[model samples]
Structure formats: structure tokens, C-alpha cells
Target: MPSILGGDIDPSSWSIIQVDLSQLNIQFLILCGVAGIDLAVEVMPDWSELPYDLLVLVSRCFNLIEDFLNFGIACKSWHSVATKHNFNSELPRIPWLMLAEEEEGNSFRKIFSLSNGMILNKRIPKASRKRCMESMGWLFTVGEDDGETSLLHPFSGVQIELPHQYTTVDYYDH
Candidate 1:
């Protein structure tokens, strides 16, 4: 006799039973109708309907570049909320080295983040080609041709114009 999963349910152990498909469907429908009646059914919240304050608070909790970036890209509402505020607060992110490869005097920059160990090679033709300073998780850069200073957030690709340089500061040496 053939056994199923070491069980004694062989051909002789059980009798063949037939089921009516339509009758079973009807019974299932009736059960559903009875259970779904007059219970003030609860529905899951939509993505946009999530609380704004809660999202901002949760966004501030993440410190890693990858983790924070992933949180912002999760949904449209999340992205909007994250960009509108300083989600990381005063918490310092992992320092990343932005080293420009000197190729024909116009080179691409390699950003290596210490937080998640992500190496990004980017070409910024629109902005500065050389790094000026790296302090407190921000990169200050000066354009080669225009000498315009700009601040960049390495992981997020966010750049902002810096005020005019008042004094000359040596970037290479102390």
C-alpha cells in the first residue's frame, strides 16, 4: 500500500468522498456575507494619508547615508517631507572623501563614504572640479574657471551656492 508522508492513510484506510463544487462555493459566499455585515470595517491607511509629523520624526532617526536615502525614496510623500526639512538634525553623518582624479586637468571625483562603504564616481561638469574643504559632512568646492564656491552633500547630490570668499584659505596645508 502507498503511504503519504509516513501516515497510515492508505487506500484501505479511508473511503473516497466526493464534494459538490457549486455547493461549497455557495457556502463560502454565505459565510463571507455573514462575517462582513455591519461591523464598521477598518481600512488600511494610504501612503499619502500617513501623518506628516510622524514621517519627519522617523526620518530624523536614520543616520546612515544609504538608510536615510532609502527612506526618502520610499514614496512621494516621504521624499517631499524629507527634502522639506533637515531630517538628520544635528547628528553628524559619516565622513566621505571626495578625491578628484586629475585627468587632463579636468577630472571626475570619487566619493567614498565611511558609513556604508559606497564608492561613487561622478562627473560634475556643471560644478567645481576641485575640492576645497571637507568639514562636518559637507564638501566645499571651488570652480576652476569661475572660482565660485559651492557646498555639496556627497551622498545626496545636493549643492548650494556659498557666499563670496572673504579671505584666502589654504586647502592643502594647515
Candidate 2:
């Protein structure tokens, strides 16, 4: 009699088993029961090894930007899927409210997601002491002292300079 795992067991009694990956835990229990093995054994799947197509499919299921970004941080392969252009465009866009800065000089800003009630703390030093408004998906920021204006993309930290506020207006004397 050969042992499966150093235990006195007959291999002939065991039959081939098919498992569904989605229901892995339940099917694993059934396999253990059929094989007369201990139920205490634990099995953990390597999520990073998931197929690229499957990972992409899972990435699309995220409606919130915060959740979508966290999915990319899971592993390198998942990061690849998240960085793809317009990978999440199919998902619904939820409005995110940018809260006031915690302190005058602090670089961190709190953003609240209306869709999921999640708050994200983002460090945007460029936005410090600037009046910000959302136009489309970018932040239109105006400098407090100089009255300069620029567009800032909060997530990507990309900034685009626009003509200064003075250039857009002409002073008229009556």
C-alpha cells in the first residue's frame, strides 16, 4: 500500500477529480472527503499567476478609481493591465469630491468618492495654496498671489500651464 502523504492509504481507491477554479475551496473540500484526507490541510492560490485575459476582465469590474488602482498594486502582471490606455473606460465614472486641505502648508489632499464612500489622500504639492476647480476630469488651478492658472491632473500629477489670468482680461477705464 502506497501512502499519499506518508499516511497509510490505498492509491487505487482515489479517482481523478476536476475542480472549478472559481469554487476552489468548496471543491477542495469534496476532493479531500473523496480521498480520505484530513480537512485541516490548507491550500492558497497564487493570484499573480492568473491569466492576463482573466486579469483584464477582473480589472474592468472596478467602478471606483481607488479600487482600480489597488488592483494594479496586487502584482506586476495586474499592473500591466491597469496601465493600459482606456482599460477602464467601459466602467462608469463616479464623481470624486476634493475636500479642503488639512493644513495650510500640507501637500496631502483628501478626496471623497461619492460612489463608494471611500476617501483617498493624495499628495499634490503643486496644488498647495491654489484655488482649484474641476472642469471635465482635470483640476483648473489658479495661484492665490500671482493669479497664474494651470491645469492639473490629480491622479497622474501632470500639470499644464495656461496663459496667466491677466492675459485673458483687458482693463477698461471709464
lDDT of each: 0.68, 0.82
Those runs of model 2 whose alpha carbons end farther than 4 Å from true positions after fitting are: 1-51, 73-77, 169-174
**Model 2, span 1-174: residue lDDT tens:** 666577875544343232344478787788989999985757798888899889878888887767888889887998988965625776668799999877887899999989878888999999998989999889999888888899999989999999976665562321
What local lDDT does model 1 show for residue 3?
71
Q: How good is model 1 by TM-score?
A: 0.49
What's model 2's TM-score? Answer: 0.60
Per residue, candidate 1 scores C-alpha lDDT tens digits across 69-137 of: 887887898887776354576776566777655564554677777767788877654334554677676
Q: In candidate 2, how many Å is residue 169 off?
A: 4.4
On lDDT, the leading prediction is 2
Q: How well does model 1 score by local distance difference test?
A: 0.68
> Between which residue pairs do clashes occur in model 1?
none
lDDT: worst 10-residue window of model 1: 10-19
